[model samples]
Every structure is written in C-alpha cells, then in structure tokens.
Target chain A: EPEVTQTPSHQVTQMGQEVILRCVPISNHLYFYWYRQILGQKVEFLVSFYNNEISEKSEIFDDQFSVERPDGSNFTLKIRSTKLEDSAMYFCASSDQYNQPQHFGDGTRLSIL
Target chain B: EDKVVQSPLSLVVHEGDTVTLNCSYEVTNFRSLLWYKQEKKAPTFLFMLTSSGIEKKSGRLSSILDKKELFSILNITATQTGDSAVYLCAVYISSGSARQLTFGSGTQLTVLP
Candidate 1:
C-alpha cells in the first residue's frame, strides 16, 4: 500500500551527541511531517514540510531540531544535542495534499543515555 | 492551543462484544478528524472525517464525525483479538496555508479471546 518507512527502528545515543532519524515517505506523497510520542503521552507534532521548506513547527521543535529533504525521496530529522527528554518514538508521516489523510511510518525509537 | 481528548484510557472486552471509542476536540479553523490503530508500531489510518453526519464504514468498523459538537466516535462491532490496539484520535487545524495534527492520548483496547 505504498507506506512510509523509517530506518534504525531503535537508536541509542549519549546525552550530548547528535542523532539523525531517517524516513522515506511514500513515493508520490507531497507533504511530510515529523511527530514524537513520549512514553504514555499523546503524539506531538514537531514539524511539517512542503515545497522543500518548513511550513510549520511546534515549540518542541526548537533550536536543537531541524528537518531536511536532502534528496527527492528522503526526509531526515536531526537533533543537534540530545537530551533525556528527547527520548521517544519518532514517527514520520506523509500526505498527498494538505487535505488528505496522512500516513505514518512504524517509528524510530530514540533512547538517550 | 488545540487540544484533543479521548475517553476511557483503557478497555478490556471479550470477543464478540461491541466497543465504541470516543474523541472530542477544541480547535480553531478545524480541518478534519482522523482515527488510527496502533498495534506494535505504526499507526494505521482507519478513517478520516471532514463533514458532519457522515458515517464511514469498513468491514465491522465504522466512524462518524459531529462537526457541530466537535466530537467523533469509532465503533467496532463483534470485536476480535486482532482489534486489540491503541486507538488514536487526531484533529487537523489549518493555519494560513499550513496545517498540523494534534493527537489525543489514545485509548488502549484489549480484546480477550
């Protein structure tokens, strides 16, 4: 069903280290998004990208967070400095248009030590 | 800030029983409401409701939205063990040309055989 795919299902890194989470959205999708879910918490939006630029971001997506579509098929989220609070399941989603339903990936479990 | 609230943090039901999940939201410029089922990982899209009084059905699952009431409900009839999963409700809000989703804490459903 042409689903979004994320790499490194599990990631463990030191508190001060940098981490990059990778996603390959549906080939024909247009809008991309990043969301994270802290254990037992509601999923929170991080950022949304379209037309090769960030269209929206939440407060949680602060200076340490950045997203880029380095190539046509890949979307990446990088955290400059990891923190204990940053540990969560990061999910990637994509939609064909603004009004379409977004499809989510299995998610990357990021654990900061 | 937009908020989504889901009721009955968890539920346990026997096979063949019927279950209904609830979701309500408060947001400006409401765009749509979506329901997803999360098993071990990714959230699989179940239904997307935009207009009121319209019921979307798939197999034994059905969902409806009440835009006027700012709520939605998902019903699973004759449930099975496979229906055990966390049901997430999310609302899309439009901001200028951008939009993002705000998710509820999700209802955990466990179907016993």
Candidate 2:
C-alpha cells in the first residue's frame, strides 16, 4: 500500500519568513492537491495540480502561495511570507484519475511565531 | 458557495456499540463523496461513494450515499477503542472549473471500553 509522504512533520517559522512544505505523492498518480485545516476547522482545499500546471485554486491561495513539481517525485507548497493565520496542518493528496479517491499524506503542521 | 455539513460534532460510545455519522452537502456538479478517518494528524481514506443506494463497506465500517437527497451516512458497528477518531466527509465537485473537495467539519467519535 503505497502512501503519500510529507517531510518536516512540524515546521516553525517567524511570521514574515518564507516556508516551504514538501510532499512526495504516490509515484503513479497524476493529480496532486494541497489542503489545510485550522486547529478546529474543516479541511479546506487550497490548490490542485495536473499536467505540470495549477488546475484549480481557492481564494485562500493568494499570491503568497505557490506549488511546484520541481522533480518527478516532489510536490511542494511555498509561502512567500508567512502570516499567523497561515498556521495549520497542511496536507498533500493525490489521485490516479479524475473522480478517483484522493489519498492523503500524514500532513505537515506549520506553526508561525 | 459549496458547503458540506456534518451533524453531531462529538459522540461517545462504549465497546460493542454501533454508531452512525451523517453528512449533507450542497455543491454544483457533484461527482463523488468520500469518507476519511482522522486519528491524529493525517487522514486515511475509508470509502468513496459515487452512486446512490449502493453501499461501500470495509470490515465493520460501511458508507452509503444518497445523491437525490444530497446526503451520506457512515456507520460503524461493534465499535472499539481503535475506532475513536474524527470522521470526515468530503464532496468532490467539478462544475466548470477543475475538481476539488469541500469537507465537512467532521464528527469526533470516542469509544470507551
């Protein structure tokens, strides 16, 4: 059972610093996604990537956020300037095809100071 | 805005008891509904229901979707301490843009011995 893997299980950074969350989605999957959850809130979709471009993004995914598949295996989310409200558990997910069940990673807990 | 609502924010039950969690959603171009189990940081896929009436089951857990009514239910029978976790329901919808997920707040279930 191959699963998505995320690096730096916990990240702590200054409010104005930049942060990058890394994920290695399942090798054969084509669609990748990023989602976040505030401490007590529902999981919110931020962005989705396919064919080497952003397929969709939410309003929360503003200019501060960017995603890339820098390599064949790594998918990363970079925040140019972190904010206190950006502190949350960021999750990476992938699916084999359209409408397929998306598998998720353990998540990286981002904490802004 | 697409929304997913889950009922009963929290629940507690004893061993061998049965419990059911409910999820309702209002989204355009509904594609599929998914159930996930979140024990701590990461969420694991449980079931994906694409059609109405047909049930998707794994062990003591089963889920069914009602597309006509715009709701879904997850049932866990003979609950154990291991079943104590937050259950999340997310709807996958693609109206005009790319597909994305809309998650409910989730139901926290605690099973005691």
Candidate 3:
C-alpha cells in the first residue's frame, strides 16, 4: 500500500517568515492537492496541481502561497510570509485520475509564533 | 460554493455496539463521495462511491451514496476501541478547472470497553 509522505511533521516559524512544506505523493499519481484544517475546523482546500501547473486555488491560497513540482517526486507549498492565522495542519493528497479518490499524507502541523 | 456537513460532532459508544455516521453535501459537478478515518496522524482512505443506490463495504464498515438526496452514510458494526477516531466525509467536485474535494467537519467516535 503505497502512501503519500510529507517531511517535517511539525514546523514552527516566526510571523513574517517564509515557510515551505514538502510532500512526496504516490509515485504514479497525477493529480496533487493541498488542504488545511484549522484546529476544530473543517478541512479546507488550498490548491490543486496537475500537468506541472496549478489547476485551481481557493481564496485562502492568496498571494502568499505558491506550489511547485520542483522534481519528479516532490511537491512543495511555499508561503512567502507567514501569519498567525496560517497555523494549521497542512495535508498533501494525490489521486490517480481526475475523479478518483485521493490518498493523503500524515500532514505537517504548521505553528506560527 | 460547495459544502459538506456531517452530523453529530462527537459520539460515544461501547464495544460491540453499532453506529452510523451521516454526511450531506451540496456541490456543483459532484463526481464521487469518499470516507476516511483519522486518528492522531494522517487520514486513511476507507471507501468511495460514484453511483447512487450502490453500497460499498469493507469488513464491518459499509457506505452507501444517495445522489438524489446528495448525502451518504457510513455504518460501523460491532465496534471496538480501535474504531475510535474521527470519521470524515468528503465530496469530489470534478470540473475542468481543477479537481477539488470539500470535506465536512467530521464525526469523532469514541468506543469504550
């Protein structure tokens, strides 16, 4: 059972600093996504990526957020400047096709100070 | 705007008891509904349904989708302490723009001995 994997299970950064969350989706997956969950809130979609470009993004994924597939196996989400409200559990997920079910990673807990 | 809602924010049950979790969604271009189990770490995939009136089952857990009503249900029978976790229901919106998933707040299930 191959699964998505993320690095830095927990990240702590100062406000106004830049942060990058990394994920390695399933090797064969084509569609990748990023989602976040504030403590006690529902999971919210951030962005979706396919064919080496961003397919869609939410309002939360504003000017501060950017995603890139820097390599064949790594998908990275970079936040230009962090804020207290940005603290949440960031999850990476991938699916084989457009309408298929996605497999998720363990998530990286981002904490802004 | 797409939305997913799960009833009963939290539940408590004893071993051997049966429980049913409900999920409702309102989304454009609904493609599939999925269920996931989350403990302390990542969420594990459980089931996915694309058609209405068809049931998908795995072990003691089973799920059915009702496209007409725009809702789904997950049932777990003969529960054990191991079943204690947060159950999440998500809906896939399949459009050319990007594939996004809307997730509910999730139901927290606690099974006691």
Q: Choose the strongest candidate by lDDT.
A: 1
Question: After superposing candidate 2, which stretches have Cα over 4 Å from the reference?
Answer: none
lDDT for every model?
Answer: 0.96, 0.95, 0.94
After aligning candidate 3 to the native by TM-score, how far in Å is the CA of B10 from where it should be? 0.9
lDDT of 2 by residue, A22-105 (tens): 999999999999999999898999999999999999999999999999999999999999999999999999999968989999
Q: Can you tell me the DockQ of model 2?
A: 0.79
- Per-candidate DockQ versus the true complex? 0.92, 0.79, 0.81
Arrange candidates, best DockQ first: 1, 3, 2
How far residue A82's Cα lies from its native spot in candidate 2, in Å, is: 0.7
TM per candidate, chain B? 0.98, 0.96, 0.97
| Model 3 error, position A112 (Å) | 0.5
Looking at model 2, give its docking quality level: medium
The alpha-carbon root-mean-square deviation between model 2 and the true structure, to one decimal in Å, is 0.9
Q: Model 1: runs farther than 4 Å from truth?
A: none
Which of the numbered candidates is closest to the native, going by highest TM-score? 1
Across B1-113, the per-residue lDDT of candidate 3 in tens digits comes to: 78899988899999999999999999989888999999998889999999999999999999999999999999999999999999999998866757888899999999999
Model 1 vs truth, CA RMSD: 0.7
Model 1 agreement with the true structure over A1-113: per-residue lDDT tens digits: 79999999999999999999999999999999999999988899999999999999999999999999999999999999999999999999999998899999999999999
Q: How well does each candidate superpose onto the true structure, as a TM-score?
A: 0.99, 0.98, 0.98
lDDT of 1 by residue, B1-113 (tens): 78899988999999999999999999988999999999999999999999999999999999999998899999999999999999999999988888898999999999999
